[model samples]
Target: MLRTTIMGLCLAAALASPAAAHFQELLPSADVLPEGGTVDLDLVFTHPMDRGPHMQMEKPLRFGMLREGQTTDLLPKLVETVNGGKTAWRTSIDLKEPGTAIFFVEPKPYWEPAEGKYIIHYTKVVVDSFSTGEGWDEMVGLPVEIRPLTRPSGLWTGNLFTGVVTKGGQPVPYAEVEIEFVNDGSVTAPNDAFITQVLKADANGTFSYAMPRAGWWGFAALTEAETTMKSPEGKDVPVEAGALIWVKATDMGKAP
Candidate 1:
């Protein structure tokens, strides 16, 4: 009887604790940059839907934009910023061309004690300048990446977003993807499960999810890294390599 009661209590305690989903956010001031204008970006490692317990981020290993089959280094523009007492990064870039610019960041491996592993989310976001909208489908060739089957820009609510998960330029069969919205603090989840929706890729490594409402939705595909890293406690731990992409959806119309 005592053992049964103890087990029940433990289960209840675990359920009572909120599960925070980690997301690497690369948010631009606007998804479509106007000609002769600058687009600002905020790079943070946090639980977007939960509004944080923002994690401290070290300097990114790589930060740049890929356009027209060329990559431009943007690391020189990053400036350290603080939010909720945690370190983050901010940068602004001038958009002069009429083509699509895909900005990406390879952050330093973050040690997550709660998960017992290090996490490195290779995050990317697309910005269309001057309405050219070209080159949105090009892959930046990260270790793990999501190649969007959809255009990834100017999406409407209820539109199905599809993408293929890839590692080392090869498709990953039945890859697991986690989807979450950048909650504006107005949206609340009824339970923890609703915070992050899970989906699996098809045999071709393609997964699809429709944005239920208009907002920024993030899709993260996690895979085991080929290498391990030393933890803060001097122990070697497995690495969680994540390929993350973000897109914005707009409402079709208002109610009558």
Candidate 2:
């Protein structure tokens, strides 16, 4: 009886915390569009490292881009598509000029029974067009956001990427950040801990992480929402607000 009880408790603990990391994928075909080309973008909610079991995403509350201090609405252009065998969004945009375009998305509140709270990730990705590489540090003014201290594009493997976590335009010291890579089924984690690397900001709300491999890495700064929202059960519950950013790192080797 004691052995059975112990096994039951272990299962409960595992169920409470999942090994898969949830990331709002705001992936672009290329982070830097040389010569002002078109960019294919995919927006989805999933465990990027695992690349499976994607969660269904509703129409986003807001999806747009900021260019030269102006906001362009992109929500009307989103088309329904299947990503990782789940419903997701896909869109494309052409860069006509040389400048920086910061694309952002505010996903609808996602209800998770395991965490017993709604999650809303304000996700952004920077794309530099025509070698201009301008304004990569522009803030999207999200409720919770990671303002990139390092340039978000054109990073090589082993380069250290840094950002500042902010809430309501104020620094959030010691904010918890989660990191994950977009796995294409080529990598495997030795354990659950390796799946999602966790870090915290410093006293000044700055945090950095060095990438060991080349691919897309996502940084998510998590915080509890200021207000509660109604759950599916008609009860008010806390919300988890995440400030997410995606950066691509490249390998330094020449192609054979």
Among these predicted structures, which one has the highest TM-score?
2
Model 1, 27-86: lDDT tens per residue? 888777656378899999998888887999999999999999999999999999997689
lDDT of 2 by residue, 130-237 (tens): 968789999989999999999999888999999999999999999999999998888999977888999999999999999998889999999999999999899999
Error of 2 at 142 (Å): 0.7
TM-score of 1: 0.92
- Which regions of candidate 2 deviate over 4 angstroms? 1-13, 16-19, 254-256
| Residue 183 shift from truth in candidate 2, angstroms | 0.5
Tell how far residue 76 is off in model 2, in angstroms: 0.7
Q: Estimate each model's TM-score.
A: 0.92, 0.94
Q: Each model's C-alpha lDDT? A: 0.91, 0.92
- Separately for all candidates shown, the number of backbone clashes (residues 3 or more apart, or on different chains) is 0, 0
lDDT (Cα, 0-100) at 164 in candidate 2: 97
Worst 10-residue lDDT window, candidate 2: 247-256
